[model samples]
Each structure stands twice: as C-alpha cells, then as structure tokens.
Target: MSTVYDCSRPQERKDGLAAAASAVRSGQLVVIPTDTVYGIGSDAFSLSAVHSLLAAKGRGPDMPVGVLVGSWSTIDGLVLSVPYQARQLIEAFWPGDLSIVLRHAPSLAWDLGHTKGTVMVRMPLHPVAIELLRETGPMAVSSANRSGQPPASTVDEAREQLGDSVRVYLDGGPSGDPVPSTIVDLTGDEPILLREGAVSIEAVSEALGGVQVGRPR
Candidate 1:
C-alpha cells in the first residue's frame, strides 16, 4: 500500500477519504478503520472487488464477507427481510458493535461468496468509517489480516500482512479494544447468537424481551 493516511490529520484525512472512496468505486481494496476493528473494504456491489478482498485475506469463497452501510435505509434496501426482532437489535446496538445476518434482496445482483441468500450488515460508529460508507454506499469488509492470522488492530499490522494487496490504508491508530462485533443470525426460525464479541448475548436477549436464541457452540 502507499503511504498510510494519518486520519487524525484534518487535511490528510479529507484527502484520504476522497482517495479511499474513489478507489473503492473503482473496485480497489482499502484498509479502513471501523468501530470494532480495522477492515479491508471494497465495493460490495462489485463481485470482482469482493473476490479481490477474499484473495488478499487468503480466505475461501465459502466464508462470506460482511457488508458495512451508512444508514438503516441502506440496510433495508440491500436486505430482503428485516424481522421485528432484528429491527430492535439494530435500534439498540447499531452504529456500534452489532452485525445482523439477514436474507439478501434477490433483486440485487451481487455475490458475497455465494452466500446463498444472506448477507451480514453492519453500521459502524467510527467517524472515518461512517464517512467512507456514506460516500461508497455499501462496502464488503472483512478483518484486515490474512484469513488464519489474528485480526489487525492497527494500520501497521494490516499493512504488514496485506502489504501491496491493499491500495491504501486509513490509519486511525490502534483500534481501541479490538473485539469484533457481535454476530446474530436472523434468517432462522429465531435469532441465533453466532458469535459474541463487543455486545453480550445477555444484552441481545434483553433487547428482544427474553426471546430464546441459540447459544454459541
């Protein structure tokens, strides 16, 4: 990757944001800051770009990547189903550390690792991430590291693994408390706790008013 963009620097941040967004629009990958951890982001609508992201991370096509959005409206548009309980979770934990896996809209022509019909969507709270999402519409983002390696919490770490695979790096410093977002599957009969991370299962259950959810194995 080229020079790491110091996102804390105002002018550099503005320029970096523009460059990053442009790169994404052109189906290029960029290391970006998210509320939970650093992510390798690309245009979600671009199948080739998504493949590039998977290839860069040394990830298999079977394991799908998650899509990051700027607002609830965008989430609603990209997904076909959004149950009442899912809405509740979004309201409670969105723009924070929560990921919702919902059935993807069949009308949309995008492949996220041949995910069948589901896509994980998140709305991050970080300023840099939000701005980029706002400009890019939706980005397919995964942890900025090789598939088996521990997730990178800083731009330097991401660059170390990703190297020239990514075109640009938005350095937001070490991601504070690099826990991943909680993942919940809403396509099943009931909400299933896929992975508990920043948000606890207790919080999710409470948000749903004691709805039963499958525990992580």
Candidate 2:
C-alpha cells in the first residue's frame, strides 16, 4: 500500500510534504492534488522517476506531461522562451486552470515524454500544491488516473487507481474542478488551445490579443 498523507491536519501536512519531497529526490513517484484534478508527479529533473510515473499511469510518450512550477521566474529556467502574449495569459490565469506549452530548453537534461522539443507547464491554483512545488522545485505531473480514463477528482479516487505504484499520496481533499487545465501551446506565433477545461476560448483569445487557435478534438 502507498503511504497516504492527510493534508487536512497541520502536522500531517508538513510531514507528508517532507516525505513527498524526499520520495521525489529519491526518484519515486508521488500522487498529489492540483487545481483541476488529482495528479501523479515526479521530479522533473529525474529521468528514471519521470519514466516510472509514465509507467504507473500506462501512458504513452506521445501524450506529454505538464510540469508544475511554483513561480513565474521558474518558467524561464525550463522553457526556451515565454512570448509576450503567453506572459499575459500566465499573469492573468496562472495559479488557476491554465497550462502553457513551450519549447524546452535544449540545455536542460530531463525527460517529460514530449515530442518536438516542447513541454507543457503550469502553476496550479492550489496552496498545497504550490507549497510542495516550492519545496521540490518543479514536478512533471499528469492526472492521477489511467490513460483514457476519467481524471481523478478526490484523493480516495487517486488512491484507488494509483495504489502502491506511488510512494506517497498527499490528500488535499477533492480538486477544484474535475476537468483538467486549459492547455495552450504558446510556442508558435499564434496561441493554440490544446485542451479546453476551466478557461474559455474567448477569455484566452482576449488574453493573447485575439491570437488564440483551438486545437482539433
């Protein structure tokens, strides 16, 4: 059985966060809560850990995972560039349900199952997740559920699906939304909507000054 942490209690939350950080450092997978849904994550810099996370989810390499960052400046360290429009979107909707995909910095040595040298990134809207990210630096995260299955909304659901595959599960109650983040590919001249979730197309388009393009369903 996985080591589950009750985030509702103050002491347990701290202990759980510490344990989760240690697990990531030791190249183990962790299941944590995000703004949109429960997520399974691992240290973004750990190639073996990232691979383990993917294996746990039975996910394909083509379906890239998103990295959760604690702050805006951290974004520059990971992605090659953050466009002006993209920055606006981040400023407006970040710490919420907006995820941006950008060209990965060739200098960084990490595997996140991305193709064409790009990676999806987000700063989740949950305080617990932010606190954990602040400690772990950055985490490669995907919804805590099997590929093609409905995303896990509660910690119990995540436990049911992920079980012992993950070393720790930070129980932050249910997620803010059952849907995933609105994924926007900001690598190109025009922003492309990869997946529509909490943020609407019109809002994203306006944030990008009318340059939003929706991805094909």
Candidate 3:
C-alpha cells in the first residue's frame, strides 16, 4: 500500500518530507502538493525514476514533465540560459504561479519525457513542496493524474488517481489554487504563452518590459 502522509502536523510534515526525499533518492515515485496542483515526482537526474513516474501516470514519453526546484539558483544550473526577460519574470512571479521553459543544459543526464534540448522548470510557492525539493534537490514532476485526466488539486484526488502506484502522498491541505501554473516559453526571442493558468498575459508582458504576448508556435 502507498504511504499517505498528513502534513498538518509539524513533526509529521518533516517525517513525510524526509520519507519522500528518501524515496526519490532510491528512485521511487512520490506525489507531493504544489502551488498549482498535486505533482507526482522523482529525482530529475534518475532516468529510471523518470520512466517510472511516466508509467505511473500512464503518460507517454513524448509529454514532457516540469522540473521543480527550490530556488532560482538551481535554475541556472539546469537550463542553458535564463534570458533577461525570463530573469525578470522569475524575479517577479516565481515561487508563485509562473513556469518557464528554456533550453536544457546539454550535460544533464536524465530524460523528462520528449524534451530534447529543452526543459520546463518552476519553483513552486507551496512550503511543503519547496521543503521536499530542498531535501531531494530537483524533482521531475508532472501533475498527479492519469494522462488525459484533470489534474488533482487535493490529496484525495491524487490518491484516487495514483493510489498504490505512488509510494508516498504528502497531504499539505488542498492547494490554494486549482488552476495550473502559467507556462511561458523563454527560449525564443518573443515570449510564448503555453498554458494560461494563474499568471495573466498582462502581468507577463509588464514583467518583460512590454514584450508582445504570442501563442506558442
């Protein structure tokens, strides 16, 4: 049976976080809460763990997953370049609802689905998620649900979808926002809005010094 952790208590939260981190270190999948939704995550550097997470979600390798980091400094090491505009956006909206896609560092070893030379990255605002990331380093995380299902916003929802496939479910109460993060592509000259969720285009444009918002090509 999967280990379900109640994060409401401080001691339980720390214990759960430690167990989840240990799972990730051992290449096991753990479902943790994020600012946007529950995410099923594994160590970003573990190829086997990445594959396991995809299989657990019934997700194809072509659907890329987002890499969750605890801080902005971690972002620099993972992606090739954080553009000036992207940096501004990170400064303004990060640890909140923004996710940026950039060219992946060539030396990185794991495959996050079909991302070839690119990576989707975010620093989630939720304290539990951040604590887990800080402990496990970086996690290859995607919304906790079956491939085509709506993302789970609560631990119960994640349990219903993932169940025993996931080793641990960190319950940090229902996510503050049911909507997913606003995904922006920063690899190109003009910012491309991939998925509109929490962050609005106007906010992103203002952060990038009035750069025109364009649809993802």
Give stretches of model 3 more than 4 Å off.
Answer: none
> Model 2: runs farther than 4 Å from truth?
212-217
Against the true structure, what is each candidate's TM-score? 0.97, 0.95, 0.97
lDDT tens digits, residue span 57-87, model 1: 9988899999999987788788887889988
Write model 3 residue lDDT over 108-179, tens digit each, in one string: 888887887899989999899998898889899999999889889899999999889888889988886579
Q: lDDT tens string, model 2, 154-217?
A: 9888878878999999999977559768888877766788778889989898877776476755
Give the candidate order by descending lDDT. Answer: 1, 3, 2
Q: What's the CA RMSD of model 1 in angstroms?
A: 1.1
Between 2 and 3, whose TM-score is larger? 3
Q: lDDT per prediction?
A: 0.91, 0.87, 0.90
Candidate 1 residues lying further than 4 Å off, grouped into runs, are: none
Extract clashing residue pairs from model 1.
none
